[model samples]
Target: MTAGILAIDFGGTRTRVGWYSNVLELITREESLSHTEEPINAVIDRIIQLAQKVVPDCEVPSAIGICAPGPQAYTGYIRYAHTLPTWDNIPLAQRISAAFSNAPTFMENDANLAALAEYQFGAAQGADPALYLTVSTGIGGGAIIGGQLFTGWRGLAIEPGHIKFPAKDGKIYSLEALASGTGIGRLAWEKLAASNTPSSLRQIDTVDGKAVGEAAMQGDALALEVITEAGRWLGLGLVAMVHLFNPQVIVIGGSVVNLGELIFAPARQTLAELLIDPLFNHENLLKVAALGDDVCLTGAAIHAQKMLAS
Candidate 1:
């Protein structure tokens, strides 16, 4: 019965749809496995159906905001997403908007939306130039500048995860390959196979970045070592980001963020060890997301609001 927003945060493995008031308060939401393996049309159908359940009785939402993976909404075309190979040619914003009485639609990469959410309502909280990193299965990030989301060059800028690194295993690696959650789990297994070191990770049934953090919390030497190594790489990536953007505030979020200071401490050390000059002046320049798991969803609403105001 209310005219609000239908916000969608679409990821590789999950798709979240939320109902929010025009003022940006979440009223309800639904989550589902993305099932990208299915036909592309079916995936879109499911999202539309979920919207029906959450936004009850509204003939049309005031607006719609969609945060999808990979390329931005430039021309409403998704250029690439390894997880969504079939989505490249579709004008997603137009399609979704058409579904809701052609409600005004805004779309962007999930990381960009997350940064906007933080800048407007969460940790960044009005910092002039802010940056956000979501270091989960992979590292994804975006930036905010002059109190607005800085989605440069067709909304393709600020992909901090892909920062370059020296060649490894006959191919050059990016920051995500070395410092993200997936990278942490991969490193743990590589270490387990290569070293005779004793650690609690050997006892876990499934070892992921989360398990590594739990093990490290329990004082496991190898687990702690693996975290430190990942943190150092993460720090190296941060150093690169700092130099590139000189952001006033940097907010780190996502599953890997739960690794907490065990990772950040070393990242900070690396920042101190490298970096020709100091840049941070804001208090807690690097910190966890205040909004937690729902950052992207909140961001979707923020995007919707921004689009409405414009």
Candidate 2:
């Protein structure tokens, strides 16, 4: 039987696992959101159990690849977790590696893996230099230079969301604090509260990002305004990235992209206006990620395969 590999995409709220082997030529996958309430050990155990169930009997995976949230230490332990607090300082790679007969396991930031997926199989395919930015609850980004993952000096590079930029109010804020899903919702709530501007969003009990997006979709003027403003911030961030990297393509994904043209339209407009150098304005430079949710999982599988081969 051909060697098998296990791929895990561990997120703040959910975890997805996939089993792959050359002999099967098909991936068996499973997902669970219940992991949020469980401890780190419990979550890892559950993932291992799921992987065993999916793998064909008598076949052990040669390696496992994990795509996790960032700020991991040099030893592969997460120093701190802004989303999944329970995983803070956990020796995730060591524990997961030990659980599987001491098989080698590789881990990378989720956004970086997403970019790798896009470069290998999604929107950035065939693009030598590309940027993959995910504008979700919080923004995260990764870069591909010369068609390889461009992890920075300390492996914590390309965090576009953390880059400080000025918002409309002239206050400097990180790109994520200004344009992420949560940021958009915060803008909507603040706008509604600061001004008497009536909005359908006010009727919602909670003014979260999804509610704001939904309100915008329903043609609420205030919600649309908030989204547009957030787009401007996103555009500003992209402009900086473009100037710095001159990427051939920028692949955008995440839950917020569901707003579609409401966000992209304004972002495109702003990007066009802000770009002073003609060298960066290539046609079709911005595209949505084609691999969708499976991008990270696919990347993890590929990474695991490479690790096992090496």
Candidate 3:
């Protein structure tokens, strides 16, 4: 029987688990809804269930690799998790490893894992230094330098969302607060409330990021305006990343990407205008992630394989 690996990508709102062969090919998949209110044990159980379903009965995976929301695993304690509050101070590695009957578990930050996946198999392929940004419920970033995931001594590096910058409102806020999917929705609602401008967005009872995207796709002026502002803010954040890391490629992904150029166009233009070095402005430097939803999970599988080799 071929050996397999268990890979888990745990997020604040959902968890994804997959089985992969020792060579890093996915065999099966499962997902579970996660909650900050639920006990951490419950989430572990869900992961275990998925693992069992995917792996063949005779082949208990060679190893297990987990990619979870961070700052975590530095000292085997999750300092504080904003997405899943119940995970705060929890011994994440030990607990997850125990659930699989002590199968060797390797852990890394989820965004870092995603970046690794891209570098190995997706958009950042062939690029030695790359940057990956996920702009969904929140913005998360990871960097690959010298063909390795770049985590600072404490594993807190590449947290792009937390970068504080001034917005049009004259207040400095985290990049996520101004540019994520959630942020895009917030911007639309606040602007709609302040302006009497007639638009289809006002007809909806609730305006979320998806709603805003849909309205913009339909040519609603108000929705388009909100997206443009959000894209510009995101562009500014990318500028900081470009200057700091000088990556060969910057891969952007997540739910917000589905909105298409409503966000990317302005962000790209702004990024080009702000970058001082002409060498950094190549058309291919910034790209959409190629692996889509499976990027982080694939990274986990790759990590497991690495552990087995080590």
Candidate 4:
């Protein structure tokens, strides 16, 4: 009945709260769509409300952890959230800590925490240098080096998605702008409008990544092309990441993972064809993340446990 960890995965699209026993087993969880228009205090209120369900008023968690989007500050400050503009300079971790009794709270970039989760209990468990990329509304990533979470000098070392590249279109775009789910959706729109491709994607009213992915699943030619192009960009980005971090393994997760092989096949093929380092060119070198939607929450718990131990 005692609570060991209370964790929150505060993403741009969804927010989740998890309760875990001392053994790190997920006891229960609650989630809801995230509406960033609400102020930070409102988000806190909702988290406390959700937390009280699994955790009674009388019980206190040993530690608390939160995983958020965008570049994270190690000093417990919210630098900025591309999706949640109201989060700039917010003391998120401190506010969460203040809500509980005698519990220490920790917060970090969701992508970074996800990497930690994979290193501790998921696909990258044994790798000394591993990488995690979460492709959702935007792309974000984290690195695990020498069996430890590699937060750079300011704890903002990894910003893979933000890395910009000059494209054939004579425009520069961040990897996220060209390859994430939002990016894929935008690309689909461009293809549909710029070319008269006879495809099912044109039938969808709002062709987002999910819609395009569904169309691809049904074997739509244009959808396939769109997904393939996104995958290629993703692979090129991965190649850059590999060269920079020299990660022994790369674990990718998030909503885009739902696209299955439709997306990964092309990325893998691209890596095979273009990656400079053949040692990491193998299929096994890159893995699908194991935790699914709970990846960040689990990572948050791990962060809390580490902080409590420290």
What lDDT does the true structure give each of the candidates?
0.83, 0.83, 0.84, 0.84
Question: Candidate 4 on 1-310: residue-level lDDT in tens?
Answer: 6567898888777889988888898988999877667777887787667766776457788888888876764567777778777777888778777778747888888899999999999999888789999898888889988777898887888888988888878999999988899999999999898998899876658899889888889999998998999998998898888878777789998889888888888888888888776876665877899988899999999988888888
lDDT of 1 by residue, 251-272 (tens): 9998888778899999989888
- Which of 2 and 4 is the better model by TM-score? 2
TM-score of 3: 0.95
Model 4 bad stretches (over 4 Å):
1-3
Better of 3 and 4 by lDDT: 4
- Model 2's alpha-carbon lDDT is 0.83
- For candidate 3, lDDT tens digit of each residue in 173-258? 99999999889899998999899999998888989999998999999999999999999999999999998888889999899999
What lDDT does candidate 1 reach at residue 93?
Answer: 80
Ordered by lDDT, highest first, the candidates read: 4, 3, 1, 2
Q: What is the C-alpha RMSD of each candidate to the true structure, in Å?
A: 2.1, 1.8, 1.7, 1.8
lDDT (Cα, 0-100) at 114 in candidate 1: 91
- Tell me the tens digit of each residue's lDDT in model 2 across 1-310: 4568888888877778888774323468988773667777887787767666666676667777888887563246776656876666788778777777777888888888899889988899999799999999999988999767888888888889998976568898898988999999889988998988889987879998899999899999999999999998898899999989999999999999999999998888888898987778766988999998888888788777765667
The deviation in Å at residue 238 for candidate 2 is 0.2
**Better candidate by lDDT, 2 or 3:** 3
Q: Clashes in model 4: which pairs?
A: none
C-alpha TM-scores of all predictions? 0.92, 0.95, 0.95, 0.94
TM-score, prediction 2: 0.95
